[model samples]
Target: MSSAGSKPALVASSSAASKRQAANSPGGHVDKRGRTQSNDEDDDEGNDTQPVSTRAWLSPILPSRNELITSPDDLATLLATLPGAEARVPDPQLTITRARHSIDSLLDRSETEASITAALERFIEAVRERSTERSRYPIALLAALPGCGKTRMCLEVMDRIVPAFCSQRHIPSLCLFLNFNSDAASTWRSYEESARHPQHAIARRLLQSYYGGAEITTNRDISVNAALSLIRRTEARRQQVLEQRLHIFIAMDGATRLVGAHVAPQFQEPDHAGLSLEQANRRFWKQALTDLQVACRSFTTPTWMLVAGTMSSALKQAVTNSRFFVLPVPLSPLRAVYAARLLDIADPKAPSSRLLPWRVNSKLMARIDQAAGLPRTLLHIIDPTTFLDTRSSVSIDDATLERVVRDGVQGSIMQHDSDFLESEALLIYRKQAPVFHPDISRVERPTTAPANLVMAAMMSTLHKLQGPDPNKAFDLWQSWEAFCAIITNLRILSAIAAHPNSEYVQVTNLFPGSTSSRLPEFFVNASAWRDYSEDNPDRRNQPVDGRVCLTPAGYTGVDSWCTVYVKDNNGEYTPATLALQAKLDQVEDCVPLSTQIEYIEKAQLNCPSSTTIVALLTTARMDKFDPSDVPPNAFILPRQGYKEFVACFELIADNVWAYNPHLSSIPRLASQFYGKGTTLAQARAIAEVVNASQSLDPKKQFRTIRDLRTYLEKHARVPNSGFTIQSIPKDAVLGWPYADDLVMEDSSITR
Candidate 1:
């Protein structure tokens, strides 16, 4: 779950090697059976469950297996998988790497960029029109999350696609690519000058790129006036050639620079300027676009601009959806298929199956998935220096894998830790520490600042939980462990909440302990057992009873919680703090939903912020359920819905311990727990089964929950046809005999 939205699912698979190597391999031809076979191997039917990863599955397809791969390092180097390395600039033809290496593929956003090529060509053509409407042509705005390959996509269009289009139309073209990032090949001094005179900075870049390193002795030649004069001079020169129109394509990398210090100057405009920084930035960029268009019109030279930037709030505010065509680059994690293909190109011999399958080793897969499919992060995680083991058969041990992942995650978090800290503190500050609450208070709020309040709440809670002669000193590791525990539980709750329609029972004890006495390991870290640290007993002899206050989730720190951006049906995401309370059925201590809502409302009264407080109450027994006890908006799961409930736990556990890459397609792992749609279907199905039962008892519908489940399974047995009951129309769902007959028929099929 990225801040942008839940990312598209990633497929994990493996391939033998790159296309060039595969093509030259001995006996690479297909056999009479139509399967690619080598001279050294005998033919065998491929496993359906574990399909071999082939380069044919790749976007810019590479061929099947390469026999050259011997180690993981070879694969990493071949793919140029290095963390923190920005996208490389492609050659003018866009068919090769900067190093002049022949490259037949662009993996990341090839489909999207290809699809938008026509639109880009139209934008260029529109700007090049001989009519006066050139001034109305807006600059193209490309938006994407960080590391989504925006720069690479923009470069492809400007350097390759546009040039091709111009050549086909017999138009002369010159492209000036301006990268404003500090480390880019841009003029860093000129970017600094943008603070005062941005137009001059643009003028200098234009002159610099146009001259191709020729000495422009005077500053006057690089001024705004000189830039327009140059355009006029070029247009007049081009007029000598009959019907030849000069098209100037300009691409601005890191367009976010336009909204920085340059925006303050725009705020001074009398009537047209906006009051806020975001509005000022928007107005400034729009004026910049208009100014460029107006300048181009002065010489009747056609010009088109492409601005690319990350999904920053300021960028979102500046680019109006109506005026400019906004293209969102998908930054989903690498799916199994992509991963498999990547491995194939990298090292064909490296064991990919162990790494790709979610169920194989979840903790390891989770770390790989946490890279969020960004090339930099993925490279960092699988970097040969840390990940690949050359000692024996390129195997990565548990200890080394743990360290590598921990370091990789640390590196990722460090990049955005400051932003995460600020956002998380803001969330807690907005909670306002309910007035008159037993543990929290208004006095705890700092008069001078809100940042310390988060720390205060954490420390305060830690002190209470410590019990008797507490360790007052801040232990960073202990604090971190507690934080992880809090985030893990909140994520579990959030996943369950996502599917309110589903109900689950039977909480599988994840840690090694007495199931009844011990809480989930995620809820109780080793630090919590302070007194018996050396022994580290599996479970405390005493009942696991206590309240644990936790901080709200943030973008960094905890991997599972970091990118889980769960949004409501209304398509709005409000970061939340979860409070969970549970009781055994014999305990009869379940809290009502209304009281929980009241507590939240009361807190909101003091500090009205977007932050939400979610409270969950669970019980071990379902037979004690009472209609009057359940609130109208609250969801209660009977024992009959226990399968779905347990599925939710399994989903969460898989993600944390062992992830099933196959289930990544599910929209919200939480909704699956709630049986959101599944609950309604189950209810209707059960009602249908019970109503149509042969029993004469009128209250058969009110039989024991177990009996109802039995009737449901016996009557409405879903066919094993790779489709859920939810996928079938309710009217078409037959009961008993019909369902049994369909199941039998489905079993006979080849599938």
Candidate 2:
């Protein structure tokens, strides 16, 4: 029905509140007093789903969450106390902030000029090694996306590193905080410098100290040009002071004293203050480093200069290989890391479901991860007060995410909007788009799982079904209606789901045709109609059908595509070919063994037999599938297949009874997916692989699926319990009689 790939999913969940409040509250609690959340308390159990603003989440984290010092005033005191080689309160990497703060205070506390003067004598003990000795500080360049907090972190560090003096008599040493942007700080300019105006307030304050009798008045606005002249006069004075104090001259330009301008020189005097033409051109690149070198050589006191910026391509040229060593801040999967780092502070009792779950889960995460290598989306899904009860643990369940992403991207070139394509896009984009596809999400499933073989053995039914199940249209429709109601107040599915307090579904009701209702009147916004996309995408001609399909450029401003990545049996990830998966499945929704093998061969995949079995089983069950240029075993199997498939597994184990290869502990594999693992799961994957081959029996090969799943949920490096399935019905599965006898539970899925 759809094309091989599709658009990146939409990200509508703003969580502006989530981002703003995630940083502090006392002991990990969020301050919810004045916050106005989009979802109301009534839906705390089963109703409202709306996308909140980003400021809700961002503002909290962005504000200084200095775990070291409780309050801003206490910060200085805490910094002055750090002692010895190392002392880590919680996280070790931040040990430097404590040390820098503590040591600077000791310098400021000096009573006598002798103590200040002897501070240089203390340098011998601190400089244990030269910059060249250890490449360990390979320039801690923190590579991150915009607004990921690098700049804020630099400011926090500077606040610790640069000491502020308390005495009025003391002229503080210059501590520069530079933004790679080529503009100078406005505060750096002096007032009254421009010919037409008065000076700035701050400039007047500084002038009071510089000149005793200067009484600057308030209210008169200084023109920018006038301020520039005064700033230049002061700059000239500073230059003279520099010449007087440390005579070994450093040349600079008359234009930009900083890095943007080239150095300029006076032609008449051989000993002129200005730089020559040759030096002028390169000064923009060299002044900061040159100054640091001079400060290091001439001053006894530790001269700490904190320089930060967006990592422009000009870095290689801007930084040099001299006496200075740049420390690199290791880049991490920060987006993914945020779940463990933030969002736990949501209020549990405050009517709103304390945390927001990505409508998509790990499978979605993997898909997005593979396709775009970023978690991004366009719709901002907001979840509030979802009830974890009998029918559904959460009102907005995983099936919705599966449908949205898999359908959204798998059918990239679909002639229609509702087409579902087989794709690996959602997982790739999940992390980057925090709201739509979160860095982390809660796994939702039923309480009990089906019996011993096929899917039951693996216990990944719900998790697996959230991806490719062919008979999911009914559920998708049900959920889609529920979604529309939550976002648009239709309540169509809610009425069917036995909502006693809710009104019936009606067009006028969804909009109320008036302003009295609080719900977002969906139809009221006529812009919601698909009129804009009724044209063809080729851009030149209309489609054969009277309707036209718009290109990405025409419909949406950006183009979204999918990239395929594969994990071998050894679990190494590499870019894989974008082959259609359905062809491999043989059945449109299922990947058959032969086709999988053929594609694997073409892609040169060298995976173990177990992975092959899982992949084959997983493929045959998809609503839409394509052969990934991937190994047969990489795909996790659907839970419903556990019993019948495990029967095959049992048969395979019989043949390979004595053919013991040095297999990694199967319990270890299970432990990776969940936590605990039974001995039966040890050979489960291998058994599944062998069972997938024609010769193996079903039971022997599939016995340990449940154990494998349990282990996976508990101990894998990145525990992905999403593969564990639990909610599917007996009749819908392949081995009906067996499923019926050992079924866990049945609801709308049973029929």
Candidate 3:
């Protein structure tokens, strides 16, 4: 190849020009630019002189297409002719050995559990001894959830069984690994049409194990059937040659995909008109599995067929019917010791690294185990590369470890498939159910649909909910579950409300106490205001404490005028400042606290002269207060309440239903009562009653109380005694858990 554009032109000397001129004169003429011009007339007349370009003389000789360039010399010559090709040529040995080393490293890096190793060893020994009828074919099924290392386990088994058989029995084992999930076999099938044999591509992979890229005899074509037959024949002939058996181990990873593929409606034929689509799909999968089972049985030698994957119910049933010896190798979360070892293997310095002392702290190890013990989860939590930087001393303290654990758990939950969320959520609920319900079996468990819905809602909330603290995300999850539990019980009550004979009682009856009888407690000390008012009879000149206590109902007074206050941060001991109310729920231009303070100063009510501050408390998550918007001396606490406020309001709403026997039939009412087009006030009222009735069951009541307590402990700012129930926002109250006006109202409540 020409190197004209590949390199800069060199300056020529007079000595080089003379040599070029002398060399060109006999064969051809040289142009001024040092280009060789062939004498066409002389060449056509059969002249011995032949002309070659100056660039051609400098170019390396290349091998022809017909030449077999196997030697290093030939390869070098061929590569040299291509521009910049010499730079691209890697060490031949390294290039050839890379795949082999990678395969070995994969096996070496796999952290095998002792149980897995022992099971494989036992199975292999049984197959060797031919101790049972099942050992004749010796098919073992390994099942696990995804990312739980089923594939790695298969590799580990092969790594052990292959060597053991070879060393002890003096027999060579052929271990074939096929991953159906990844289409490992199908990928090679694409090349079969052009290959000399049906199994040519597969045989090539097989040959790599024995030869490691060294030239092998490939003139003879071998099909898959022929390869298996050859293995049987070779084993029979081994008696005469080495007196050893030829053990053929065929391991299929992701065997579940085989069933999944055939079960998929698109892959099944609809030729049978009598059969439904589902039936036809199942039949196709059954046949495919039967064929695989038969193929495994056909192997006559001491053969081992190992299938591993996330086994579905259908797949498991099919395997059992085939009479395969099922050796369950379930992958568990990695133990701390194994995780540490894996980390060490991934990064040799990880075990000693100060930054990631995962092994040093037992508490950290336990936390990691709880957070993500699976191989994939652990790796994701602290990737090998994360500890690669050695210049700076890195330390994973308790806080950092906690964050990592939280991140890993959150990621695992989020990454889980929606179809599996119900089961995962059930697992979480089961752990807590025993504690909350002593008679867990009797407690009505949530169905898959509701559980999945709750999980989805929680996930959506987590995605949108933002704050500075990472722990808040976890707290949100706890609060969400509590919310879900309460709603679930309420839904159960609605279903129960279909019956007319169900008794309805007051909210206080459940607690059975005079003190806890009321839905919400209100406390106020009016002595200061009363005493001040008596001293100055003129209302305009009297001092007010501004300490009036109001329940949710009291907040919306019969009169248009309402009193509100800004509490002093120093303590509730100092008198509160009176303020003007701008909005309740749906009023426009709801003035900010700062703007309201200005309004209070201008519209002074009948009160003694005193510095007043505007204090507004609502269920809304308010923006951070701007000091510039208010006076410097003003105390403004925004978003004072947590989600507990919503929970409390919901509880009060439930109480409305419990005390009002007439509303007991709300669940049976028509759509108009809770349907779309219903006003916010209407929806809130209906929802509270319906939900309260639903939550009246003894079990439900207990669950609600427990969930409420937990929610309060995590997110509530004040004790139950100090807190007052507030009304829910009109827009927020109409949902599935709450009553929508689209639902019919029961006129029976009026009775």
lDDT winner among the candidates? 1
* TM-score, one value per model: 0.43, 0.28, 0.37
Model 1, span 1-751: residue lDDT tens: 0011221111113353233223322223343467754221211112211112332233122221222222222422322333321232211222112312122244545556654565556555565553334224545666544444556666666657777777777766656555554233343453355443344456555544443322222222133433533432333343333112456677666776555435333222332332455354454454333335333332244556666765454554455421333444333323333543343344333345534322222233344433333433334344434323111122222233223222222222222322222111110110111001111111122232433322332323322321111123221112322433332332333223233333321112211110122121122211222112222222222122121333243311111111112245675543332222221111112344454445434433322223322222222223434456543222333333332322212212122211121221222211121222344344444434343453323234222224434544555455542324443222212211112122322120001
lDDT of each: 0.34, 0.24, 0.33
- In the range 1-751, model 3's lDDT, one tens digit per residue, is 0011222112223364334323322233354477664432112112322322332244344111112222222222333354443333212122123322111222212333454455546655655664434443445677554545566666655555455645675655555554433323223232232333223333333322222222223444333332343323333333333212455565666666544233322222223245544344334334334323433433234455667766344455446644445555445444333454455455333335535344322223323333333454445434445313211222222222222223222222222221122112111111111001011111122333423332222222222211112222221112222232222222222222222243221111111100111122111232222122222211222223321211222232111111222234653333323332222232111235545455334434322335433223222233455556554322232323322222212221122222111122333221213333444444345434434444423233212223333432342244532222332212222221111122212111111
Q: At residue 374, what lDDT does model 2 achieve?
A: 22
User: Per-residue lDDT tens digits of candidate 2, residues 228-331?
Assistant: 22222233234343211211111111112132332222111122135445334333334223323323322222233233333322332243323234443322
Ranking the candidates on lDDT from highest down gives 1, 3, 2
Tell me, by TM-score, which candidate is best: 1
Ranking by TM-score: 1, 3, 2
TM-score of 3: 0.37
Candidate 1, number of clashes: 32
Error at 185, model 2, angstroms: 6.4
Cα deviation of 75, candidate 1, in Å: 49
